[model samples]
Target: MNTAPHSLRPLGCLKAGLRQARQQRALLCRQMATTTSSTISSSSQTAPDHGFYKITDPKTQRLRSAFAVYSPSAIATSPSALAPLIQPSTSSNPSGALARLIVSPASPDPLPALHQVQIKRMDPTGARTALFAKTRHAARVGDVLMVTHRRGGEPFAGVCISIRRAGIDTAILLRNHMGKVGVEMWYKIYNKNVAGIEIVKRRAKRARRARLTYMRQAKHDMGSVSDIVFAWKKTRKVMTTRGGGGGGQRLVVVLRRRRRRGSRSREMREGVGERRGRGEGGVDGNRLCSCYLFC
Candidate 1:
């Protein structure tokens, strides 16, 4: 009985220890849960509301919430008071609608406005119209074109093989032969680096296809066009000399001669000839005179 009591005492102590351990584990789990809940609540309270309007801070150069400038309470209390602050939309005032949409309580879609701005910036000069329009003189496939660079290099002359027209992203492919090797280049038409584009030679006959890729073969190739380009440039120079202010130099020489004659007549009227004369009628008898020839 004494041994039985001793063994029973050990089992009871083990049960008590297990119960205390379980209680400690439960207390630890409860503390962790409480801490996590507190952290989550604090984070929720401090989180920034991205739905609100944002204004740029001039001093910090950062975007901040506009709650201070436009409070919800003020908007709710006197909606009518802010009506005058909003620009009135009218048919005569195109920008009024944009202004109202920006300052309104709701967020406005920016896609339409951005698209208009992009379209306006794409082709401000209407050069694309003159180049790609469906007219008789517009640049087309198989036409020789010269592209000059704004930074100054030898102008590239080539046969236009293909044209890709995608609004601001329009481009053209040109092919030429250099040192018996074929060379090709792609040029963006509206790029700022491109100085000018001129049609050098039109095709003898209209190309049956849009892209002249078949010209890459030996049988269909047009070969080196350097001679044609040189002749065209020479002819252009001759035409410019004949028509563009070529007579202005001659007219200037004639004007200079007339001014000289007028100055001589003025000097004669001032009695300069009489002062130097050796005989009557303001004449030097021994000197040969050219006044009669001038008269």
Candidate 2:
């Protein structure tokens, strides 16, 4: 076979090899330029330094020491997430006030927190004393109560006839019999003069109605008041005493002794009689003396 000249070999193969070499060089240059731009951008984005060296860096090894110096709760901006949003309602004692007796911060222990209820009518001349409950839950329907009146020396022992439980204006109806006569007394539960209320017995019956009105017409059952007992707490009185020499203040309580009825009037009568004796000797003087003493 005859050999062809090397220069005269296919001119198309030589042109294709030159074109491929140019394309590889262009791709290499583009990749090098892209990698250089990314490195420069990353180095320029460093964070600014704060003056406090202890908390500034994790590499300093003292960031935890600064955090331990402060209390988390002292700087907190919100209340505890677990606490309830509303307070539960409680029954009020006779002083037209509601108070809770708390024993400690960690544990809230309940105790008897009310005392001494007296009632006054719209007329200034009328006043009465009745038995009072120390707390709302301390008194209930179908209970026997011993009420001591301010005027009468003897106590009125009765069964709770009815109860009107309007918040702040709660009252109880009490019933007792004098021979053949039935007597009923409606007492405001929160009065200040109610000397004391002692729950002698609690009836076994659980009354559905808050008021025990059915007891009024029904015949008496002697067995209803037996075999049940409950303990009661007396209401507390706040008595203030003045400090002597004034270094520190002290609290003192004074117990009130029961007073007899009409003793106050008798004292006023004796004073008026003496005043009349010194002023004149006439019918007008005698009448004035008697009016002040007796009426």
Candidate 3:
């Protein structure tokens, strides 16, 4: 027996032994280099094929996916990493780095935000009064509206009262067809019986005051008989009181009121020959007169 170490015990044996030891060391080094830890780590985590989660690195520049999931712990470490890419996540957001690392981002979504709504059929003829009810019969402030009233088969026109937003439906003020501007009226969705409940295309926002515009235009275009007497009264009040004007404005107002009212009071009594159901006209008529007087 030779007194050599086991590796060098024999020429063939020693060579084989040394080669085996060398190979084992190389294998151990390779294994160490590939491992995330001292032990083998699983590759079944959320991440892109490139191995990064949340696409923080984004392998390349364009948006990676619709959304990236992240780990809260790992995410906190690189809190500002996503700032340039998208809107800042809220403090309550759970998206983070590790979460991204664990799961692949989702595909980008293409969704529309708002859609147009349509009114299929509304008693178009009665739209004026209906619109008035909706607008609370406010003044025709900004622009004028155009309407088409069908007297027999021919269409006519006029201006409108104010238009306001009432819940989802738009409310508008319309001068009564009876030539009483003080008789502004309204029509709810359910009550469109004038001609037919057919809503024409929505108005192009020519003026911010769609209601008033429509009222003004409708009288001309639709040829609806207008009751702008109340409107005139209201305008005269503002011009007389708010700004510097001649006493003539007051005289004009009083004289105009006396002439119109004196003649109108008799007309009103004759026109409203019978009082409508208490709640239906009493309260509303009062409101109409008040709007004519003040607002």
Best by lDDT: 1
- Please give, for residues 71-158, the per-residue lDDT of candidate 2 as tens digits: 2122222343112111212333312111222311232222211121122332122222222333333546777766655565865656
lDDT of 1 by residue, 100-133 (tens): 5455555345566664465456556656545765
Worst 10 residues of 3 by lDDT: 110-119
Candidate 2 regions with alpha-carbon error over 4 angstroms: 1-137, 218-295
What TM-score, computed on C-alpha atoms, does each candidate reach?
A: 0.47, 0.30, 0.20
Residues 261-283 of candidate 3: C-alpha lDDT, one tens digit per residue: 67566554443323223224644
Q: How far is candidate 1 from the true structure (C-alpha RMSD, Å)?
A: 22.7
* Stretches > 4 Å off in candidate 3: 1-158, 165-167, 177-181, 188-295
Q: Please rank every candidate by TM-score, starting with the best.
A: 1, 2, 3
Q: What is the C-alpha lDDT of each candidate?
A: 0.60, 0.41, 0.37
Q: Which whole-number lDDT from 0 to 100 does residue 120 have in model 1?
A: 58
Q: How would the candidate models be sorted by lDDT, starting from the highest? A: 1, 2, 3
Better of 1 and 3 by lDDT: 1
Instruction: Write down the worst ten-residue block by lDDT for model 2.
Output: 286-295
